[model samples]
Target: MQFKNRPNECVTTTDGREVWLSRSVATAVCILLECEGRPYILVNQRGPGMPDFAGYWNLPCGYLDYDETTAEAAMREVWEECGVNTLELLAQATCEFFSAPWDVNSTPRGARQNVTIHHGLFARVAQLPPVSNANNEPDETTDIRWLPLSDVETLTFAFNHHERIADFLAHVEKLAGISYR
Candidate 1:
């Protein structure tokens, strides 16, 4: 049986006929918030003591627990990692798909199994966090900031998040009917 497009699911177009769905193993979220009349993306930096990509920045991300839905996990993670509690899902937006395999030698968890799934989701907040993300968890995140999308290209990101951000921006223009300057 072939997969059918679910309503509001994300699809991409290429060369008129070529199209595909985005997928990833775990969910990562992009929360678009604005300040001073400019759009910004919320990102968190890893703590220096972490095993992987320590000191690198990334979107609010986490693996889905056994009982939690993607959106639930996303909300929980955002609250856990960031101090903001006002974000709600832009559930109508298509989920940007991502695919990749865990390193076999480095991690026996997946045994090199590649996993694909949608993000926690593209969510939104009414405004920037007044006090901002304060990592109260165990040394997971060191800092959080709202940075202008225009300056995104200049920063260092972990896990190819830079490419992910670019993909999100493009999709916002194409599917969301909003253009980023």
Candidate 2:
């Protein structure tokens, strides 16, 4: 059987023999909170103690638990990483499709053995309440902030998150009237 475009489900690879090997499925929510007529994106700095990609900037995102929707994962990640309860999802975007090489040595617990980087983007409109939690956070993520998308290019963030930043810059123009050519 072939796969249809399901925004929330991960599809198995084309080869029929790969059952246990599955694609890495994850999602991200880009909350564009407006302040002073400017668009600011919520960003997080990886925890210094994280084993990989530590001290790097990235969007508030995390893996989806079994039976959880992308939107749910996004909201949960935002709350866990930043302690803000978002009201609703405003818009959603999918990353450009690309085939990623399969790796045999890297194994993150609960990570899909067949890892392909597919990104889903979400936008939240309302302001979130200030609530911080120390116990409920991924070891790899630390420090959260909302910054202007135009100024984000100056920061040296992990390479994987650069595409989201580009998408974010586009959203800033569409939502906040900020243009970058």
Candidate 3:
């Protein structure tokens, strides 16, 4: 699947020189396991207005703000995107993807204009408290669901997120000494 909106781009500066600009965005994806020690994954409904992966099932995550640590951003985004305030990081992993710079002249308003090297940080939440979104904008997520890891294939997840989900599930399955296809 080709995403029209990418993080990298080239621009023509005032001097008529082509300038390449790249952006680094950090996101935290939460895999909230069932509190009863069962093997299940927590997912959230993405906010409708989000340009990428909106209205789909996704892990609780968002961009790491400037001056914020990855851990800080992870916990914060979890609470903001989902109604989970008591989240604790159980583990972490990262994934990155690259795209060529593209013109944003036809891009959506307020889009991140540049080539983006996005870092996805995976986190396991220890405490899953029922929470609400603090962000006033049409939040990127509106609902949350807990599903067995085996059912991940049934959810409509973003392209970049699928691999990380599989990797995390595999790690957990290995730790529990359970066989998963």
Candidate 4:
């Protein structure tokens, strides 16, 4: 089929078909110890000047690099954004595929079409790490915090990350044979 370039995001086939390319992203849901008897999860706020969702909270996530496994990328993002180096990945929580009509003027870079793989990890720490001092990508993340699960519903999240957090919580609940609802 004859190929036509579409600004590196899509290809036009000979038969007038457009095929979109997707980027694989890895997201980590890091569960930490109970604080004041409430379970908390790690999250980061997007830095100012971010291409999309600036100032919004989200799980530690990023596009997977070449030759890197999703789990490896997830762990790396956790360290870069949350400054947490110790984690035991429990499982692959979920995978989500998202796509929309590509608009060159409005679509954020690296989000034309994305396949996000979420991994659930547990961190054994008595206190939260000093993110500002240890974060490797300060430009990508402005703040890192351990958000109590009870407060998730009150915060705004980017890229539907709230759903990912919910899924992880459900998985943990299943494992513990307890239901929050």
Question: Candidates' lDDT values, in order?
Answer: 0.60, 0.55, 0.52, 0.61
Candidate 2: Cα lDDT at 180: 46
> Mind giving the per-residue lDDT tens digits that candidate 3 earns over 79-145?
6776554233333322111121111122233544322222222233354445566652576667776
Model 3 residue 172 lDDT score: 42
TM-score for predicted model 1 compared with the true structure: 0.65
For model 1, give the 10-residue run with minimal summed lDDT. 99-108
Candidate 1, RMSD to the unseen true structure: 13.2
Per-residue lDDT, model 4, residue 9, is: 74
Candidate with top lDDT is 4
Cand. 2 TM to true fold: 0.60
Instruction: State, as a TM-score between 0 and 1, how close model 4 is to the true structure.
Output: 0.67
Please tell me which model should have the higher lDDT, number 3 or number 4: 4
TM-score of every model versus the real structure: 0.65, 0.60, 0.59, 0.67
Ranking 2 against 3 by TM-score, winner: 2
Off by over 4 Å in 4: 1-22, 88-111, 123-125, 178-181
Residue 143, candidate 1: Cα error in Å is: 1.1
Off by over 4 Å in 1: 1-24, 86-116, 120-126, 131-136
Candidate 2 wrong stretches, greater than 4 Å: 1-19, 88-135, 171-181
